[model samples]
Target chain A: MNDFLFRLFRNGETRLHELNYLFWECTTRCNLHCRHCGSDCTMGSRDKDMPLEDFLGALDTIPESHRPKGFTVVLTGGEPLLRPDITTIGREIKKRGFGWSMVSNGYFYDEKMHHLLMGAGMGALTISLDGLEDSHDWMRGHAGSFQRTVRAIKTASAQRGLNFDVVTCVNKRNIRELEEIHSTLESLGTPQWRLFTIIPIGRAASDPDMILSKEEMTRLMEFIALKRKNPSGKMVTTFSCEGYLGKWESQVRDTPFFCHAGINIASVLIDGRINACPNIDRDAFSEGNIYSDNFYEVWMNGFKRFRDRDWAKRGICTQCKQFRNCLGGGMHNWHGACEEPLTCHYSLLNAE
Target chain B: MKFFRNILKGAALTTALFVFQACYGTGPDFDPGIEMSFHVVSKQTGEAIPDITIMTRGGSESKWFEVGKTDSQGFAKIYGLDYKHNGIDFKFEGKGVTPKDTLINDFSKNFHEIRL
Candidate 1:
């Protein structure tokens, strides 16, 4: 109750005036090749790494009006940990009196990285963990990736101040092992597990095999429901609209800023180009380059394109009973998840 | 102590089971068994946080649930909670606020402070 209450009422962690978050793709270099990677993070580099000075300069360009109180900066990538000077990056971000966090594949996380992040005053570490052992290794396309991820979890779990959470991207292949992974998370003393329905874009968009059928998604929702009802489960499960059906299905859509579609969030690619979201095609939606253009203008203009979507002609979103509740589910999520009329998953579940 | 400063907001937010309630009633919907009261306040300003919704899913029925909004003193009394049979899983959301908080502490403790 204390933690939940804190999350509900607190505003200092969320100053009204400050820019909430900035998702910067630190680098495109990664060691693993996950089949469903939206960013297509490869073991080889795109050679589009943002220099430290350039990143800092762009950050500095953020007008003071945007950040009455310093904003949070989430360093992400094909694998942010791949950067040799990640600690220095963390330190520099912290020096500005702003929150610092990283989203990584957990391949490079070890005692050394832990020390560096802790010293640099990192606020959180969101590591990707899709499944248990064989399933995880299969998804990552590496033999020993599972063991390394376990090591990373253990290291992260032991940290006194540094916060950590597991991000499991759900897809067709590894959906069955979710319960087993949850059990493992509990045994390992993991605080939480983030279950994300895989979004089809980038590498995933090119492959039709990655998207989950409506039936598969329904089954997944049932599984999540049963898990939440269980009394002994320690880890909290945050399901998407498919998982938590009903009126709350619109909670995400109504709260636009929290999602990628909202103007508050922006993604910087490894090449310094900006996109509304990392999952979207960079070439097509590259809002502007962070190097040459101002970051604020690019974000406002690029996100306006999404905010002004035409739900009028776009799918079931136009006539659904709950059309007013969720504006076409959301521009990016609708585009990435569906090719047909965007029917409300909740409405379908209710009819059943 | 200011817990937000000590614990990461992301960690806390993810750990919470966020639920939004659109109705309120004390009729047959409640169990009249285990009851709990909560008071919410902002640590930064030391002021009560009113109109925050408090929700929980635990009771005698196969799928029992309860939801309510906080009063002016940031206080709300939740009744019909099946404390003996079900576990504690609550989500407290403030009105018009960007950040969402939940039952990360004991509601019976009377007062809880969140660093805003």
Candidate 2:
């Protein structure tokens, strides 16, 4: 039913005129060996951090007209703070009239780094804290990671007008502790708590235990809904925009499930491969490269596959009624090595 | 005076929960049924208003279910609703007060003060 409707309503080749967000994988080096590290980043990743000049040059390649006002370039990595010249990079990014922020593992992010990054015009920071001390330490594969992350949250919270949020990758082990995690974040004065289920990729692919079962996913949805329905005054809880959740669509998140990859979001990976979201397998989704392809041209003219969703109509998506709204869930859910639509909330939860 | 009493009741509820957690080392067990309390007052006079109808729907597909109407004290206690982990959309309608709609996604938050 959905397959026929999609084919009928599908329009001609769509193009992206401007980018709202750009993810620059500044460094591949990470301080922690997380159990579910999607990028498989390590303390000594062979892929060298891209030179600051390379990113700046790519930004320069995009014409001034194409760069939308308030467009932010998100600096992501195995751990962005691991880069020695992170402050300089932030400053450079700001100088180009673009807002800059980063996602970190929160191991090395302290009070000093928080103020330094903010001084460098850093707009926001997203830190990962999976569960309580024990659960967090286990997921991060470090003993004192939980303590440092809490300290970082405190530092960020203390900074007035500083925007920051703690993201937890919900796994089987920590799934039951969500209420405790929420209370902990609220106590820490954190502004937002973003929950995300682990994607079966990279190291996570090797450990099937990391993935949440259908029942757990439903509970996760209910938990998020409960949080939104009865908000914690100290903090706001939101589920990450990962997949289609049907009835839980606007209930759990601020907006319906829309895959922003290659549409409003794009990425320059650690290896300089241009893709949509960094989570998508780099090889399968690379539109072009920063070294060879013109950034603006590739963004505007290329990414035909990402912009169009007709091809995604195969598999379970063909039968799902919410296909028009979800468009086969996030690209990462169905793309790469995924044998099926592993993360469709409607199908997983059996929501009508 | 009534508003102050309602506020005290909410505080007492929180203190009781805290004491319960302190004793048991965990929060209360998950209850299948959700109970919500609303205290609606007039924005201009700060006086309790009555006969306000509170309606709810699980999602767009579900029909709106009128939770109940406010009483003489301008308070309504709604029970016997299954939250089922779905956020419920609530609509408040009454005479002389502006009708308002609020989405309640968190079941933990039960007490709502609406000035209409």
Candidate 3:
């Protein structure tokens, strides 16, 4: 309950407008090249690590108030652990009473990471999975990356303190293996499988083929529905794409709204700027730089300006009933790369 | 009407427990559709920015569409309308606003506010 949130709720405009989650892209340098990476993350020039002090100092700027629940700081990167100080960073963030979660390709994982993160007080560890092995390795552009990730997850989960989950980006190359991936996680005692609906944003936006069509996404949703009815009894499947559809979100409370991007969750780039959405064009959608500006002011004024726009009448999103449920999925295609609104394909497909 | 509303935690992604039963062609009815208005104001100040023009198609193909300007209350109302003004695009030409041209979306919201 920071001051910004207190004012927001006080004004009675508290419709999921509290910044609860923070996404810190610790580094853009990753060892494996995944085809569906929204950040277009890679090694070499992309490897600009955030100074540990800059990241930690930015935390102090977060307005402290009576929080209704715990705060979460999600550490992501080209593979966050590539930098040795990740554990230290994680430890510092946890010390602030913030829940800590990190996403990694898991190539650098060893027993040391498990112990380090566990000691740092990890809330969960999300590992990237494309398919089982062939599908995952193909998407990752590495031969044995699957073996590496599987081993990493196994080692980390062995410590009861560390929770393991799989984050899969569903694209043409690996849509068929959703079930197989789910079962593997279930077998591993891993609970959740978050399937990200690949939107054409970063490198993928240039290559339209990487983006899934409405039919493809709808079929995937149908598959998810089927899997939900039957008892996988182990792994749970959730879709990032579900946020775009017109429906009540399972995870969202009371409201039909989808994301709290500027409202609640915000992404901090390596340069210390706060972005509206993690997947948005980083340079364009930036609300403000935390180093020079106030995080709360930037988020309230700079970031949340999108919420003021008339999304219900915005192009393809206008006619659909679900338009209100999603605020055009966080103004995603503002770059104008796509021909139509991202969810229009579904509206057309569903209409058919 | 500001009709509202991702980080997945562990313990299984039980979406079944949390399902979105969304059906197309069915949602809130944007009644008395033609009667629409938008308020333009400074997001930083929360006060009105006057003299901004609001251009519109008024949901018709004919260029005999619609246009109006904001009153002292920062409010602008479309003059002539009978059916739904779904295609209305409010091009607010002002000095300090970010969105030069904002499409006036579904009147389901009825009263729209454009904050600069």
Candidate 4:
């Protein structure tokens, strides 16, 4: 621990601060499509997998100065593990001195595959586990997805250098089972667990009834509060859940910028398209061609365009009480439904 | 008392050596190089945007160079430029959106977005 602290604070060690965050969605194809997925992962009309050359070209655009000291690049997908070249991509990222992370369903954690990914600088693996086996399997639309996810967690934990976490989407169906899910993850020895409130988009948008009500959301927050105070409790981490909930009640309440999609976090689509946030679909938001444009140029120009918009100045987001914190939520949510304020109730509840 | 004073002196010397090592072990006058990358994307869908223009100017009459297009990841490489003394500008025009410009700085980091 002492050594870790020393390294963390070392002046020359670039790992101290993160300059940027990249969410690289290598492929939109997935084996299981969950009902609450914000990205509509189950949809069949998504872009094809990103080509290897295009992937490399994207990596090549990172400016030397702005490169993160502890650069966190998250490789996401319909199921990132399904991509045949994930190991190779992971290796290349590590070679360039970036911290690597992945968000997957955990259905494909084979021994060889895990080894290859770990070898390529896989720092953190976040597997989605909505609830217990029965609940998770039902939500994911696969009979054995829960079991496979648990196995993947165990396998990842048993590895020498891999850190594992579970991401849960809290909704009406699984709100009652959060405690059980927490306990299960803890028992499995997972290092961390993040709970996100379901954003009504993608499949969930098609079936708004699947979303949790304000009362249910409140209950979930109560549970989170209890878990936070209880050291021995099963809950490991609570990301933006509290804040998201708080923001949901009164749209006018100010909160920290929720979606810095364009500024800090970026998503790379399968066909080489880049987006500012994960919320927007490829068809809705195409900033530039990564293959032919300077990454910095396109990003800066995009930000300027976004900031200069009339809606940016006087949209529903402007009237929002929590504009400080919510910041129009994610762009996709804003673009998807203009009537709503794109605020996450969970985020508002946790506001400091 | 004399022996105790000598021991204290020795301890102080060791502490000084450790501090010196911590500060200067890497190098005495090492200049940390600036190495970073960025991604540019559309605000709505989170996809990469390409073919935008990036230009940098240092003085009043600095020449403008057309930086390369963004890759599949909406990322472009700006290699080995000293950002401390230079002012950078980016421009992009796409369908359904007007042309946009931004002044690049250190705080916003790499990934940028444009809305359409």
Once superposed on the true structure, which residue ranges of model 3 sit more than 4 Å away at CA? Answer: A1-16, A66-68, A159-163, A206-209, A247-257, A336-340, A343-345, B1-116
lDDT of 3 by residue, A122-240 (tens): 56567777787998898888999999888776665554434455677778867877777777877776665666666666666666556677677767777766665675686666555
Query: Which stretches of model 2 miss by more than 4 angstroms?
Result: A1-17, A337-339, B1-116
The A-chain TM-scores of all the candidates are: 0.83, 0.93, 0.86, 0.82
lDDT of 2 at A26: 90
Tens-digit lDDT track of model 1 for A1-352: 3323433433332232124466778888889998787667776876667888888877777766565332557787778888887766765665554566777778888765664455355656677787888878988889999989988887776654444577777777778787788888878777656565655555676666566676876676666656666625566554532222453333322211122233345666688887655655465456789878987766555454545444333555546654433445434454433443333455555555
**Winner by TM-score between candidate 3 and candidate 1:** 3
Q: Using lDDT, give the best candidate's number.
A: 2
The lDDT of each candidate is 0.58, 0.72, 0.60, 0.57
| lDDT (tens digit, per residue) of candidate 1 on B1-116 | 23653364347553332121110000011111334566777756778889876655422232322355577888765433233344556666666554444543344453444433
Q: Write the per-residue lDDT of candidate 3 for residues B39-85, one digit (tens) a residue.
A: 88988999998877565432113332225557688976542222242
Every model's DockQ, to 2 decimals?
A: 0.02, 0.01, 0.01, 0.01
How large is the interface RMSD of candidate 3?
A: 24.7
Docking class for model 1 is incorrect
RMSD of each: 17.0, 20.2, 24.0, 19.9
Clashing pairs in 2: A225-B105, A226-B106, A228-B105, A228-B106, A229-B104, A229-B105, A229-B106, A230-B106
lDDT of 2 by residue, A1-352 (tens): 2434323322211232246578888988888989998889898999998999998888887777666544677888888898888877876776666766678888897755664565455666678898999999999999999999998887776554445678898999999899999998999889878888877778898897699888899899899999999986868788877777767766786644556577667788887788877888687779999999888778888887778887887777777677777788878776565456656667877754
